[model samples]
Target: MSDELPDSIHLVLVERLPNHIAVVTLNRPEVRNAINPAITSELGHVVQALNADDVWVIVLTGAGDKAFCAGADLTTVGSGQLDDLWTDDAGFAGFVFAKRTKPWIAAVNGAALAGGLEMALACDMIVADERSTFGLPEVRVGLVAIAGGAFRLPRVIPPAIAFEMIATGQSIGAQRAFSLGLVNSVAPAGDSVTIALELATRIAGNAPIPVRESLAIARRTSDLTESELVRMSDEAWSRLSKTEDFAEGPRAFLEKRSPIWLGR
Candidate 1:
C-alpha cells in the first residue's frame, strides 16, 4: 500500500493480511501507540483507501503489547498542537466520527483508554485480549472524552457502569467488559488479532454488499426509533435487490453450490 503521508510509514503501519483483511496497526509503540497529528492524517487516508479497495475486512490494533492506544499524545497536547489529532471529516484520531461502509473490528491488544476506547467503540465490533483494559480516563486529567467516549460508552455498555467509569476514570478488565456485552469476544493474551482475523474471515466469506448495508443500519440502532429502523431496513433491501450478488446468493443455495460474490 502507498503511504499517503511522507512520515506516515513510521507512525502508522498498514498491511494487507490474508483473507482479504487489511490490518491498520498503530506503530508509535515508543509512545504507547499514542495518537499524533501524523497518525490522524495517515489513518484517515488509509481508511478511505481501504473503503474504495476490494478488501472485505479491516482490523485495527497497536504494534506493541503494552497498549492498544494511550489516546492523544501528551507532548502534542502540551505543545498546543492538539488540533492536529483531528480531521475535519474523521474527527479525533481520524476515526471516532468518520463514515465507513465496511465492517471494522478493533483488536485491542492492551489498554484502550480515553480516545483509544472511543476508537474501539467506533468500530463495528471489538476483540480484546484477556489482559486488555478499557476506560475513559480523561476526567482524571481535568478533561473529557471529546472523542465520543463519554456518550458512546453509555450506549455500548450499561449507562450506570458507563457513568462510573467516565466519572471515576477507572478501567475495567477484559472479562468484565465481555460480561457486560462491551466486547464481542475476549481471547487469551496476544491472541486478539488472530481471533479477530478469524471472525473477519468468516464475515468476508459471505456476501459483502449486505454486510456493509447491515453495518450501516446497525450502527444507527441507538439513533433511530423502531419505525425509522424499519424504513432503513426497507431501504437497505431495496438497495441490495439491485446488486448481482444478492440474487446469486439464492441461486447458488438452490443449486447446492457455494455463492461467488461479485461484491457489487
Candidate 2:
C-alpha cells in the first residue's frame, strides 16, 4: 500500500494482490507521468502479465499525486519517438488501442488529458480523484484524439457533450465527469488508486470464468445486433451452466451459505 516505486522501469509498476487483482502504476512523476514509448512498452508487459487467469483485474494509476498522466510526452514525441509509440502487440501507447478480454480500471490521480484520457476510455471503469481533470486536448495541439477517444467518448456520454469536450479541448472536473457518466466514482485526491484496488479485489473474488465471460458479453453487447445479442446471451447462459460456480450458487442459496467459487 506504500506509494514508493522501484528506481527503474521509468514508466510502469506492477503490484500483485491476493485475490488476483493487479495494480499497474504509471511511474513518471517528474514529468507528470507522461506517456512515452518506454512507458508504453512497460505497460504492455504489465498488461500481458495481468491477462493471465491468475490475475483477474488490473487497476491503472500514476506514481505520484500530481498526475495520472499529463498526456503524451511532448519532448519524446518531438524527438521522433511517436512513430513507434505503441507496444508490439498492437497496443496503442500501451493498452489504449488494444482490446483485451480481461477487465481494467483507470484510477486517475490528477490531470488526464489527450492520450491520457484515451487510456482511461480503454479501461472498463474509471475511478478518479477529486482533483483529477479529463480532456481530449489533441485538437488544441493541431492533432486529433485518434486513440479511442474519438470513438469511445460519444458512446459513453451524450454525443453533444462529448463533442464539446473533444472539439473544445476543455477539461472536465472529476465530479462533472462522474455526472456525465464518464467516471465510475470520484474519491478524495490520493485515494483514487486505493478505491480502484478495492473494487478490483471485490471483482477478483468472483469465479474467473464467469467474470471474464460476463465482461465480454457486456462489452460486446453494446455493438451487437438484436439477433447477435440473443445468440451471445444463449451462448453465455450455456457456458455458465457448465461451470461449477453455477451449481454452487443455487446450492449455497438454499443452504444459506456463502458460495465458494473455484473460478472454474
Candidate 3:
C-alpha cells in the first residue's frame, strides 16, 4: 500500500491497507455521511482506481460513529438537484450500480436508510454495529428505492420481509438484520468498521485471483439456472486452475508451510 491519496480524493477517505485491503470512508459526517454529487464522484474515482490497483478487498464505511449514512442528502434532493446525485458510470453513491469486481464489505456503523441501505445491498457482505439500523424508507416520501435496493433486497432476504420493509418504511435493528441474513455479522456499537477490517484481512490473505473469480461467479450467476451456473463455475475453475497460486497451495501443503500467494 502506498502513502499517497489514490487520486485527489476529498469527499471520501481512501486508505490502502498493508494486506491489500482498502478502507473507503464516506466523509460527510456533518450530514450523517449523506450522499451528494461530490461524494459520489470522488467515490466513483476511488472505486475505479482501487479496481485497477493491487487492492483485493474493500471496506466501506461512514466517517463518524453517528451514522454510516442517512441516505441521499435530502437538501440536495429537495432542491431538485437529483440529476447531479448520480454518475454516468457509477449509480447512486458511486456504488449501487458500479462494475465492482473486488469483494466489498459494508461496515454499517449506524443508521443506513434509503440509498444508504441500497449501497449496503450492493456490497458483497455487510457488518453492522449493534446500534445500527437498516431501512428503505423512500416510500415514506412517495419515492421508491430504485438504487438496487428493491431488487437486491428480495434476492438476499425473504421476499415477505423485504416487502414488509419497503412497504412499511420501517427500519430493522442490526441483530434482526443478522437474523435475516442481510448482515454477515453484528459487532458492538461503534465497532462495525473494526470487525469489517478483520473480515477483510481474512479475505485478503487468500489468493486474489481465485477470490475475485469466485466472487464474480457468485454475483453473476445469481439469476442463472443450475446448469448455467455450473457452466460458469466450471469456466471459472478452468481459469483458476492455471494460476500459480493454484499449484502453490498443494505444494505448500506438502511442504507443511503456509502458502505464499503471488496473485498471478
Candidate 4:
C-alpha cells in the first residue's frame, strides 16, 4: 500500500542536500496512532535501512494531527502478537530500545503517553506540540511499562517527577515538559513536525561526524564517575583532533569563510 512515491502514509524518507532524514510515522491514525506489531517490525527495518543509507539524522512522528502515538495497540496486547512482532533488535517500538550510532529526533505531534513517551525519550532530542501531553499510565492499567519507560523517564526529567508520573499516571502538559528540560522545543499544535524539521535542517548543515561523536560523548559522560569522565573526555578530545573537520574549522575561521566540512 505504501508503494507510491514520496510522502507515503506508511514511512516517508527524504533527502535534503547533504543530509538524509527519515520520518517514521505511525500509520494508524484512526486509532490515535496506536502501534500494532507490523508497525513495530517495519519500524526496525526502516531504521536499519536509514542507517545503512548513511542518513545523518532521523525524525520520527505519527501520521495525524491528533496524536503522535497513544501506545501499543490494545488489540494486540493480550494476543501474544506484540511479542512476535518485535524484531531481533528487541527495540520495544522500533529504534527506541535499540542502539543507534546516529542522532535522532522525536517530533511529538500530540498526545505522547506510555510507550509513546518512551519512544521520545529514546531519541536524542524531543520537540513537542503545544497541545501535546505526556504520561505513563501503565500503573493505572495494572501493567508495568515494558518499553524503556521506567528506565528512560528518570533520566529525562527530575527523578521525583519521573517517579510521580509513573506512580500516579498524571499527564503533564507540553509547557511543563519543556520547563523540565524534557522537551527541546514546543511549537503550535500541528506545527511540531515542521519545527522539528527546521531544527533538523540546521543540524544537518553541520559536519556529520562531529554531530554523531558529540552525541556519543554526551550520552557516555552524562552520569559518569569522575575517573570515567576524565577518561572519556581525554579520549574524545584525542579522537576529534584526528578528524579533517577539526583542521578545516580553524582554517575556515582564519580565511573568513564558511567551513567546507568533509565529515571525514
Candidate 5:
C-alpha cells in the first residue's frame, strides 16, 4: 500500500540551503503546482520536520515559473477524497494553518490565486516576481477562499480591496500588491526565490530567538488588544532574556563584534 501511494507524496521537495535556510518547493508544476492529498500530507510533514531542525527560516515556492500554486487539485478534491486534501494539523496544503516557529517566506514566481494566495498569506513575508499576480479567485468557480484568504487578505491589505478581490474573483498585479503592503519585495522574473534567499540570509544573521519572538508578537498585533500585546511583549522579553543569544546581543555590541546565536 505504501508503494501504491500516489507520486504526489514525493511531489514536495525540501532543500536545506546555507545560512540555516530551508527551501520547500511544490513539485507538481505540470498542474501549476496544485495541492493534492499527498502534497498536503507531505508538506505538513516537511514543515514539521523543518520546525524541529536547525533551519532558521523556510522559503516556499513552486517548481515552474508559471505559478506558486493554483490551490487544491480539484481533480482529487472533487473525488471522494476531499478529507485527504487536509491534514490534522494544517488545514490545506499542509501549511496554511500549520504550527511553526521559524519565519516563512513565500517566493511567488507567477500566479498565486485561491489556495495559493492563502499559502502565501500564511508566510511571514512574501517575495513576488514582478510578473506574478495574486488573488482569491475561488468565487469564479463557485467556491469560497475558506483556506484563510477570505480573512487573511483583508488583514494584510486594505479590507475594501481584499473584499473586492474576493467578491469579484480578480487578481492584482505584483506592483499593486507591493504598494498595498502585501509583498515585502518584488523581484525580477524568476528571481523571487533568489530575493527570498537574500532576505532569509539577513534574517539568519540576527539572533534566532529574538527574530522569532519579534515575528510572533508582531503577527499577534492585529488580534491582540493593546494591553494584551504589552503583556505578551513583556512575557516574550522574559523568555528571550534567558536565552544565551539575549546576553550575547548586548555583550557583542559592547565588544563591537558579531554575536554567535545558540538558538536557545
Candidate 6:
C-alpha cells in the first residue's frame, strides 16, 4: 500500500491497518499539524481514496503528541493560495461535509483549535488524549468557525456550552469535552491513536452492510420527525434484510461460531 501511494504525499501519512481500518496522520508536527493548502489537498485525496477502498473504518490523528491540529495555518490566512484549500465536494480538509457512508474517528493527540476542532467535529466519533484541549478560538482573531464547528458543536454538546466556547474563544480540557459528550473517550497521553484504532477495530468487526446503512440513516434523519425517522429506518431494514450478512448473522449465532463477513 505504501508503494502504491505517491512519493509526493509528504503532508500526510496513510497506513492500512488490520481489520480494514485506515489511519491517516497529519504529518506537519513542527507546526502542531496545522492545516495548510498542501495538507488539505493531500488529506482530501487520501479520504477520497479510502472511501472507495475496501476499508471499513478510518482513524485520523497527528504525527506528534504535542498537538492534533492547531487549525488553519494562520500565516496563509490572507494568502490567495488558501482559497484552493476548499473543495466543492469535501468542504475544508476534504473530510468535513464529505458524503461518506463509512465511519471516521478523530484521535486527538493534543490541542484541536479553530479549524482543527471543526475537523474533529466532522468525524463520527473522537478520542482525545487526557492532556489534550479543544476549542474554537477563531472568535479571538475576529473569525468564526465556519468549518462545521459552530453547527456540529452545538448539536454534540449542549447549545449553551457550545455557545460559550465559541463566543469566549476559550479552550476546554479533554475531561470537560468527555463530560459534554463531545469526545467519545479520553486516552492516556500519547495513546489517543491507539485507543481510537481499538474503537475502529470494534466497529469494523460488525456486519459492514448494516453498520453503513445504520450510519447513513442516522446521519440523514437526525433532524427529521419520529415518523420520518421510522419510515427511513423501515426502508433501510427492508433492504438490509435481503443482504447476505443478515442471514449469515443468524446462522453464525445458531452455530455458536463467529461469522465470516464478506462485506456484501
Clashes of each: 0, 0, 0, 0, 0, 0
lDDT per residue for candidate 6 within 1-264, as digits (tens), equals: 221444236899888878988888899999999888888878887877776778899898988888989998888887756566677888877768887778999999999998889999888899999999999999898887888998989999999999999999999999999999999999998899989999999999999878888888778665898898889899989998887888998899999999988887
- What are the Cα lDDT values of the candidates? 0.90, 0.82, 0.89, 0.78, 0.89, 0.87
Error of 5 at 171 (Å): 0.9
Encode model 5's per-residue lDDT on 91-136: one tens digit a residue. Answer: 8888999888999999999999889999999999999999999998
Q: What lDDT tens digits, residue by residue, belong to model 2 across residues 153-189?
A: 9999999999999889999999999999999999987
lDDT per residue for candidate 4 within 208-264, as digits (tens), equals 878887787788655678798778777877888998888998898899998887767
Candidate 6 CA-lDDT value: 0.87
- Candidate 1 collision pairs: none
lDDT of 1: 0.90
Worst 10 residues of 6 by lDDT: 1-10
Candidate 5 weakest ten by summed lDDT? 1-10
Residue clash pairs of candidate 2: none
**Cα miss at 245, model 4 (Å)?**
2.5
The better candidate by TM-score, 2 or 3, is 3
Q: Which residue segments of model 4 deviate by more than 4 Å?
A: 1-19
lDDT for model 4, please: 0.78
- Better candidate by TM-score, 1 or 3: 1
Question: After best superposition, candidate 4 residue 184: deviation in angstroms?
Answer: 1.1
State TM-scores per candidate: 0.95, 0.91, 0.95, 0.88, 0.94, 0.94
Give the best candidate by TM-score: 1
TM match of model 1 to true structure: 0.95
As for lDDT, the candidate ahead, 3 or 5, is 3
